[model samples]
Every structure is written in structure tokens, then in C-alpha cells.
Target chain A: MVAASSTKSISVTLRVWRQSGPKELGQFKDYSAKDLNPNMSFLEMLDVVNDELTARGEEPIAFAHDCREGICGTCSLTINGKPHGPGKGIATCQTYMRSFHDGDIIVVEPFRAAAFPLIKDLVVDRTSFDKIMQAGGFITARAGSAPEANGLPVPKGDADRAMDAAQCIGCGACVAACKNASAMLFVSAKVGHLGLLPQGQAERDRRVLAMVNTMDEEGFGNCTNQYECSAACPKTISHDFIARLNRDYLSASLRSAFRPEAASTGGGGA
Target chain B: MNLVGSFFRSSIGRKILMAVTGVILIGFVIGHLVGNLQIFSHPDHINGYAQFLHQLGPLLWVARIGLIVAVVVHIWAATVLTLENKAARGSNYGFKHTIQATLASRAMRWTGYIVLAFLIYHLAHFTLGAAQSATFKDNLKSYVLTADYRVAGFPVVNAGTKVADVYSMVILGFQSPIVAVFYIIAVGLLSLHLLHGIDSLFQTLGLRSNKWSGCLRKVAIVFCLAYFVGNLAIPGAVLAGKLSPQSAKISAPAQR
Candidate 1:
């Protein structure tokens, strides 16, 4: 997509949420981005507004961001009730100011969910996800010479599915968009990425059980099959992974129930 | 911890419970519809069928108890999950936009409540005889046996009996336009609920696949619609005076 000349810059108003800290009572503060370049990304427009606020002896807005490109998934904001703005399959940083009309009031707020406590302004502490990851998001592989990739001979279909689940960026967009604040999509993606691979077979059962248990402990809600998470996901992760997660968890529970020894055995060779 | 306690506490486990119980209830629904469709047959046929069921005695009660348990479990799980989901989203979005949910899926809770209410009212009107309309119970109480009934020229020994004659009750119960309309509306909602629910149940039970998801959804929709139309035709036929109390007896003459 080509951007127009900077001379065609348009002015817009932003109702941005402001908060000093996690416990602070946040409120939307109005700011103007006058003569902003139409080609400027959403973050650039925010930068312009923050610069103006600083110049005017006012504290600039605090928001989380990195890798102005879309990949990092660090830029989290609910623009006009949409995660990563109105565009499909694009993150916040990838959203151009041209998507908005001149003089439009764009409401920018943090991803609102109990699990994601606000740090300041649009930045929420997503460490809860990190906690979930710490629970069982790893596979134990012995330290040795790297094995031949083709030796495993993973089915192409399984690999493709695993790759689809591997695309998750931990953005918390799913939680933000979900009416239930469900972490099912995120957890399933993480579980599927490893569970679908032969290397992850050592602790596949334990991984799903541990991660799902941790997810509940973190106070995230359940998946009600609303499909909002998949729809709002910038990575385009399919909700089918959640069903797969449930299947894995169910079978794991049953196996653990009937054959306790099998579930407790140490990591076996592939 | 006991396996049962842990199962109910987890979200996915609870969903699985809901799905399993839902399948049981749906099975009952199809059975009930098939039995009720027998109303189109001779009065003796439906009345004899009801008598046969009553003869099962303890077995019939066992099935009833099982259905009650399934219904209770399904409703309990749904309520618990819905409340948890509500609390999860403590703060509402100032401007909400739904990207993928359908009207039926979005209004699941409402339809669930409606279906529950209809179920209770239905029990009173038919099963319990508590809220039997004027036409149903009164007409059944005053029903006069005109002749000895026989099916296929074979003697039905217990025919022309009046012990809990469900045939007359159904025909007379639907005579009132209000009662018929309510049943129609309730069945309509039942269809809507099933449209989203059947597919969702398969997904919850981990029976979903990329190759079969679309096909499963289509099957759910078609089945729900067929169920709705089949049930609707009953009350509709009654309201249209096509399946009245007399039609059952009038359709076929008494055979010795």
C-alpha cells in the first residue's frame, strides 16, 4: 500500500486511556494529532501526539511498543473496540492512520480483562501468559548433536498444522477480544505447536494437563465456542486448535485415570 | 481429589459434561417426536402405545429419572459457565463489535431459558396433567367409546380403554389457538438452540476436524430444521382442524 504525500496530512482526535500505574483509576484523555501524515502508522501518530504533549508541559502517554513492525505483537491496544484496529489480520503497529477519517474520534484503550492488569495507559502486564508458559510450554530434549531433520519424517499435514499453531505471538489479543477472557486459543496454540511434533511426544500428556491447569489457576475464563478469539487474532490462528487441546486434555485425563504409571514415566526416546 | 470433582471444576471438563448430557437430551427429543408423530395414526394405535409404555412401569420411570438428571446437569453446567464468562469480562468494551458469532449463538442463554420454561409448561400440560387446557382434560374425561377398536383386522384386547388416553389429550390440548401458537414458538426456539448447540457439542467433545467441520455444521442445521418442521406440523395440523380428536377415530372404522 502506498502512502500519500505528507502535504495531505489530516488532523484527528484521539481519546486515549491514561493511567499512572496498575492500581490507578484510568480515564480517557483527549489529544489532537494536527496535520498528521496520512501515511503515518498508528504508532507514529501516537508519537506525534506524545511529542506535542511533552512540548506543552504535559506528561506524555505511556504505552507498550516494540518492533514498530507487526511481528513483535508488543503493541497492544483496543482501537475502537477492535484489537489491532479495524484491519483484518494486522497488528496495531501495522494499522495506518489513513484507515481513519479526518476529525474522527478514535478511542484507544488497553486490552481490558482481569487477567491482564493495566501497567499504565495502553500497556498491560501480559506476564500471566509468561506464567502459563512457564508451567509446561517446553519439551525436554537431550543435549547432543543435532539430529537430521528428515530422519523424523513428520507428515506434511501435521507439520502444517503445527506451523499454524506456532504462529501465535502471545499478544493477548484473544483474551481482549473474547467475551469470556478465554485463554483457550492461546493455550491451545502453544500446546498444539509442540504436541503435534514428534519431539514434543516425551511429555505431551503432561504439557497439556499442566498448561491447562495453570491457565485456570491464572483466573482466565473458559472457551464457550464463540469463535471471537480466532476472528480477532492477528496471527489468524484457527479456533480448531482449542478443540484439539480439549481432545488432548480429555485423553490425557483418561490415560492418567486408568494407567497412572504411563503418565508418570520419565521422558522416553522418540 | 475425586475424578468427578476435578472434572466439574475444569472448564473443558464441564463443557464435555454439557455435551454428553446434551446428546442424551437430543436423543430423547427425537424419540419423543417420533412417538408423538404416532398421533397421526388411529386413536387406538397411539392410546395402545401409551398403554404399552405405562406397562413398562419401573423401566419407564427409570428413563424419566435419567432424562431429569441429564436436563439438570446440562442447565447447571451452562449457568456456571455463563456466570464465569461474565465475571471474566469484568469491564465491558465501550464499543463492541462481534466479528463471527451468529444471532442464534449469541442468544444461546436467552433461548436456553426459554426452552426451560417451555419444558416445564409442556410437562404440566401433557405429562403431569396439572395445566391441562379446558379442551384436553375435559374432553378426555368425557370421552365415550363408540366401538371396539381393532388394528389390521386383529383384535386389540385392551382397545377402547380410557386409562391415561394421551391421544385425546394431545388433540384437545392443541385445539386452543393460544396453546398451539405457544407450542409453535417454543419449538421454533428449540430449533434455534439446536442449530448452534449440535455443532458446538461436536466441537466440545473433540469430534471436530477440518475435513468434517463444515459438513457437521450443515448436518446440525438441517437436522434441527427438520425436527422443528416435524413437530410444528403436529400443532399446525391440530390448529387447522386436520388432526382433531375425531380425526383419530374417524380416519378408520371399527373392525371386528
Candidate 2:
């Protein structure tokens, strides 16, 4: 096969949101990106932009990304108002320039949330997510010799549900795309994962109760059932996790109310 | 500051705070509803409830302070978080309507602020004794015992003594066309806030998932409606004269 020495590149204008700090006024700065390879990952394209900014003695844009392989869930960018640059099941780093035609105007911005504060440019501190998870998620299983994987025969339905919830990467993309910045999909995923597994059964009541209670304590707006989060989720995690969470929360609350002694005993089992 | 930071910034911290504070607020609402329901139970019951709160001595003071702190933190965290979210978005969209957008989602922030304003007004009118109209002061005087014990510009009295004319104030305030209108608007905004706020809390704390979001939404809607109706009942009863203002006194002996 003959090797090609040179390949044609496409040029596009990028309107990127720029902010000095969380408190500073922010605006979009437009730059014409030239000679970009279609195969370049979205972050790589941004690297080019940073290089140009550096060459021009300007501050480089700030954005968040870790483990570009789509696992860490740290890369958060909303392209043209869609999280992860309009791609389904792909992180921002996995998004390639091939998705856009030449001369297109790409609007790049950070995921928005009150709980998520912008450090600079497209980078935001999403530690609020960690706080939410910390509210209540752990089971009382003590570390011990590895038991057989099949030691616990979880119902097929519970296993499937648990697997579904185990998929969330804590990306905060769902929160970013949501109109109210609701984190239901994210919360539901955690609740569902633990709520289904037999190991999670012990703490199931407390988990749901604590999680839902903590969710309200945070300043995030309530979900209005718009389902924007599920639609916008890159993994396409279904909204069913939220239903399971609700059921768990209700049962936990009811059990605590009508059967406090039984609920306490159940808590001890976990 | 770090405590505040952890409280507002972290998901678990926020969830804890939200749950604890939410439970407190919910408890307050339930208690308030129970006390208000006394208007239906008997005029003396409602007045007795007000007198009981007034008689709390140091306990009343503690409860008031606690409530103030809770309200402040709740409002502060909400405002800060909302502002941060707006900043994160960088620029506001210029009115692109989408099919899936709900009125609750669209007005989430605005409705929250409206509710905040309403809460302040509500506190001022009821708790802080801010005069809404000429009749409110007269009505309050009839029920609430206003002694020389003025703490922080608010009238205070012993718990046993009937403080300001609470029942008449309720009636008179609701009777006023302006005040009645404001209450309606305030409760409406509260309903909207609850509708979205409850669902959002679950999501923020990572308790929601794809499967249960629909059910949660329905529950949120139902609860919001219930709260709205519950709050609206007192004013509705007042306006209809089912609960007469003149007959409503905190220390009034049994009519039977």
C-alpha cells in the first residue's frame, strides 16, 4: 500500500465559553481552528486551541478530563447544549472531529449546576457528586476471604437491576444537561445498584431513606419527570433506577413509621 | 467555613443536610397543619395551640432560633448552588423551546426565589408580626398577649398568655383582598418549588435511576398538590366565613 505523506484537514470556528473564575464574568471567545485532523479526539482539538492561545500569550482554556477512556467520568463538556458533544455512549475525550463538518461552528461549554462550580473555562468542581454518594451507600459487609461469586444467589431480576445501576461513572453529565440540573438519574443509579443486590439488601432501607433525605438537603432543584437526564445520558441509563429508589425510599419510610422495631432489626441484619 | 463548604459542596453532606433540614421543615409543616386544623376542631383548640407555642418559655426561643438557622442555611445553600449552576452554564439560552420541557423545570429557579420571598413574607406576617393591613394588628392584639417584653423589635409574652390575635390575624389577613391574593400566589409558588425540588434532591444525592424517575416524578407531583391544598384550606375556610374571625380567640371558653 502506498503511504500518504499528507492529508487534507478541515477548519472550523469554535465558540468556547471562557470565564476567569467562578465569580468573574464569563463570555464566549471565538477562534478559527485550522488544519484539524478529522481523527483528532475532541480533547486533542482543544489542545490545539490551547497551543494557539499559548503562542498568542493568552491563557489556555481550562476543562476537566481524566482517564480519557470514558471510565473516570471526569470529562464534562456540553457541545451545542448537549453533554459529551452530541455523542451517545461516548465521553468528551472519545468524541472525534469527524462528527462535525468543516466550517461548522462548535459551541463548547461546561456542564452547568449550582452544585458544580466552575474553576475556570470549561472546568468545574463537581465534588457535590461525591457528597451525594457519601450520604449513604455502604453495606455492613466486613472484609473477609473471598466468598464464591455465586455464594449469594440474587434473583435474576435483582442482578439485572443491580448491573444496570452499576453503570454510572459519576460523570455529572446528566446534571449538566438537565433543565433543573436534577441529579435523579445519578442518584437513582447508586440507589438501584445497591437496592437490588442481596448484599445491598441489608442496608437497603437505610440506603434509600438516607439517600433521598440527603438529596433534598442539597440545593439541587427537584426533578419534574422531564426525563431529560436519561435522554442526555451517554450510557443511556434508563430512568427505572429512580423508580426503584422511590420504592425503596417509600418502603423504608413506611417501615420506619409503622414498624420501627422491625426496621431497626432489618438495619442490624445489614 | 469548611463545615459550610462540606455541607453545601458535597453530595452526601448536602443530602444529609437536605434530609435533616427537609425533615425539620416537613415536621414544621405537619405541626403547623395540625395546629391550623384546630380551627376546624374548635376555635379554642386553634387558640390553645397558639397559646401553647407562646408558652414554650426558653423552648420557644430555642425553636425559633433553630428554625431561623434552618431557613437561613436552606435559602443560602439553595441560592449559592443555583448561582453556581447559572455560572456553569456560562450563557443563557435565548428561548429555545423543547418538547420534553416541563413548566416545573423551566420555572424551577424562579419559583424557588418566589417561594423564598413568600416564606419571608409569611414569616413577617405571621411570626414576626409585620402588619399586612390595618386589621392584622387589631386581630393579633385580640389573641397574642403583647407585653413590654420586646426582644429584637418583636413582641413576646409568657407561653400561657394568649399572644397577638393569631386567629383574627389569620382571618383578617386572608380577608384582605391583597393579602389573600398574595397567599394564593405564594402557595402556588411553593407547590412548584416542591414539585421539582423533591425530585432534584434524589438525583443530586445519586439516589435516582432511570427506572424509578417516572414514579418519583408522580410522587413529587402528588405531594406538591397535597401541600398546596393543605395550605390553601385555612385561607379558603376564612374567606368563606366557615371560620368566623370574631368567634376565633385563643383563650375563648368552649361555646358549647
Candidate 3:
């Protein structure tokens, strides 16, 4: 292990959250990360620390990561206070040692929220997000084969806006950044992504209603329209999706409440 | 959930409640501010206005009850939602931080509560006349109308009528430095509250979109600043001696 800070290498101290398991008492433990290449990713630096820790016969710090690239939403670390570290449109794995000065003390913790309880050091169970997604069912579409490009013509405005919402990686950075731990941004993104497409129209009403209901049921807070989630999003998802979700939910519930056919057929049973 | 159940139970429902009642309260604030601006006009205009409102009697009570209902619902919705929001957070973060939230947005609950306090004090000071010293309250001036008061070029009332003096009450109320300072501070907080409140109102109601969000933010900023300045002008003018408290006191009728 590179144990010393060389002339060309930078070293820093990591204040890491050490929780052995779910429901375990956790505490921030300081560990000096020595001889780190400045260009190494934050996750790679953690790997180096773990290697050294294992050699010393100490239980290595546990963290979560996958695809080390920015695409996968698996890496969930709140570097310092801001989620995914002090950067915009990048996840924890994408954060590099070069971003910090030498000898900087970096604080690391899991993406903390009631809906996302920590399971181990720097890893939280994000299954609540999966539940929210399940609540919003599959949109009606051809399943067997790839359809023609122009099979369903979509408006340019809607297609573009839908793509914008579709970029959300479900990273929970929005929830981590939110003061109230609101999942409005995350749920709204899925709702907007599916709700905007031509195929999405069939289930749009039920989709928005169910997803938002599940989101609240999972102990997620309501949107305060602060836009902090957007700022923290690795994909920079817009809070406008939350507004769309609000509009869609209200319209859907109202339409269901005042269904003309159901009301008119109420006496037909006689 | 059923429509009524959704309105009372869900987060989105509560948000819509806040927005709808927000619309009503915003209307009241705008109308109250604009009408009070007539304090700079001839005392007859304001006193006549006051007498006209007083003449509404039952209608005025209807409006009051309506405003009271709006305030109650607005507060109730906010309280319930805020508590849920707090509960949702569960454990606090070890490290505190914020990225894009505005100071006003973060302090919304505090500002709303303080504004509620300010509203009660304001009603007591001006509406009930309970805030002022006993003699000061009794000696407030009146206006004996010299000409018929017209609305849209039609006479609403005949000439030679007496009306309660609103102008003197306002001027005297603002003449005290402590009251004036408090008024300015409270209005400032109210404007800060409005900065986020107006923007959030549009967002919560689904009226806002990316296309309009930018323009809406600019409009909110300008409106909040303008509202603060409008509120400032009254107490400021009185404190500056642009209007005379002594002259108002001299014109007051003899206490019965």
C-alpha cells in the first residue's frame, strides 16, 4: 500500500460513518487515506483504503457502488453534507480526488432519509423507490417487437420535455438534498417520463395517482417547491416535473371522482 | 381516496388547499393595501370609504367571516402539512447544508407564523382601536361630508353626513416610533414570505411550467419588493413628518 504522501501524490483524511449493519449504532470514524493519486475516483480511493484496512486485519469500511460510471444510480454517498459530493450533475463514483485539495478532511455518510434507512456504512436501502415504481404500472405498449419510428407521432415539445424527465437516474440525491426528504422530484420524473408519451396516455391517470400515493405512503415528504432537488440531481432533473405531477394527479383524481359513465349507470343496475 | 377525502388527507390535496386559500388572502392583501393608500388623499375620501364599508354592516360581516375562514383553512393546511413534512424527515442529518433553497423558502413556516401574529396585532391596532392609549382612541377625528359621495358617477350617499375618521387613526398609529419600526419589520418578513409563497402557489396549482417558471420568478421578486415598498411608504411618510399628527389631533372631535 502507498502509505506516504509523495511529492506527486496528495493525501487526505476521511471521516467515514462506520455502521456494522442495519439497526447497529453508527459513529463517524476518522481514517487517514494516504498516498492517493489525484486523478483516482472517490470510489477507487475507498477501494485503496479498504485494501489497506484488510491488510491490517481491521474490518474494512463498507460502501455501495456499481458501474463506477455516472449512469448507474447505485453509488449513494453524501460526501460532506451535499449528496454525491460538492458537484452538480455527477454521482459519488464520478467525484474524483483531484476535486479536493491536499489534506482536506472529507466527511462521508449514506444518503440519509426515513424512507431510505441506512443498512451499513455509506449504504442505505433504496427499496422504497422500487415500491414507488411498482405502484406506477407498465404503460400500454407493443411488447413483442420493436415498432416503426413514426408509428406513434409525438409532438416535438412533449417529446423533448418527456426526455428531460426520463433522465432522472433514481439516485435519491433529490431526497438527500431536500430539507424535508421529499421524494416529489423522483416520483414526478417517472410520472412525467411516462405520462408525456402517446402510449402513456392510456394509463396516465392511474399512473400519476398510484405513484404519488405510494410515494407519500413510503414516508416521503411533500414537495415544498424549493428546487433544491434539481440542484442536487446528478442528471439535473427539473422540478417542473413535480408541477406536472401535481397537475396530472389533480386532473386524474378529479376525472375519476366525476366519471360520467359510472354515475349515469348507477341506476341502470335496477 | 374520494374527492373530499383526497382534499383533506393527501399531501397534494393539502397543497391545493393552501394555494386556493392563498389566492383569497392575496386578494384581501392587495385590496387592503390599495384602499389604505387613500390615506394620502383628502381625509374625506378615506373617511367616506370607511363609512361606506360600515354601511355594508351585514355584508361587511359576511366578508369578515369569509376572510376569517380563509385564514383558518390556510393555517390549518399549513400546520398539518408542516408536521407531516417534519415527521417524514425522521432523523436529522449529522451535517447541515442547503444548495438551491432560498432563505425565504426555508423560513416559510416561521414567516407565516410571525405574519399571523402581526395580523392579529394589526387588527387590534387599527380595526378594534384597542392598541392605542384611551384618550388617543377617543379623540380620533371625523369628517362631516360637504358633498355627495359618488360611485362611478352615481351618488351613493347624500351630502352633510358624518363618517368615522380613518385618516387620523392611521396617522396617529404610525406616529409612534416603536409601532412604526415594528410595522416595517413585519411587512418586510411578510414580503419575504410572499417571495416564496407566490412562486409556490403557482407551482402547487399546476399553473407553472418550465416555460413560465423563469418569468414567474422574476414577477414574484418584483411584486414582493413592490409590496414591501408600498407598505413602507405609509409608516415612512408619517415618521418623516410628511403628514402631521398635530394637525390631525387638532381636528379631532371632542370626546363624549
Each prediction's DockQ?
0.63, 0.09, 0.72
* lDDT (Cα, tens digit) per residue for candidate 1, span B82-187: 8888887766776687878777888889889889999999998887778865544444653333344444675443635665566778878888888889899999
* Candidate 3 interface RMS: 1.0
> What does DockQ come to for candidate 2?
0.09
Q: By summed lDDT, which 10 consecutive residues of candidate 3 chain A come out lowest? A: A1-10
- Tens digits of per-residue lDDT, candidate 2, A1-270, equal 111233457899999889999899888889899989987888999999899999999999998877888888988888877888767767888888877778999988877776677889889887777877888766777958878988878888878868877889989888877766777788889988887777787778767767656665555554545677777776778776665555555456556555434555554353
What TM-score number comes out for model 2?
0.55
**Chain A TM-score of each model, in the order shown?**
0.92, 0.90, 0.92
- Clash list (residue pairs), candidate 1: none
Better of 2 and 3 by lDDT: 3
Fraction of true A-B contacts recovered by candidate 2: 0.18
Model 3, B68-155: lDDT tens digits are 9999999999988888888877767777888879999999999998899889989888887678844243466456766776767876
Sort by TM-score, best first: 3, 1, 2
A265: Cα error in model 2, Å? 34
Candidate 2 regions with alpha-carbon error over 4 angstroms: A1-80, A84-159, A165-227, A238-270, B1-9, B40-42, B90-102, B133-165, B201-216, B237-244, B247-256
What TM-score, computed on C-alpha atoms, does each candidate reach?
0.91, 0.55, 0.93
Candidate 3 per-residue C-alpha lDDT over A1-270 given as tens digits, one digit per residue, 9 for 90 to 100: 112232467899999988998878999899999888877888999999999999999999888888988888999888888998887888988888877878999988888889998888888999999999999846756678778979899999899989998888889999988888899999989999888888889889889888888988999887888998999899988888888888998999899887655556663442
The residue-by-residue lDDT of candidate 1 on A62-95, one tens digit each, is 8788998878879999999888888778888888
The global C-alpha lDDT for each of the candidates, from Candidate 1 onward, is 0.83, 0.70, 0.85
DockQ winner between 1 and 3, please give it: 3
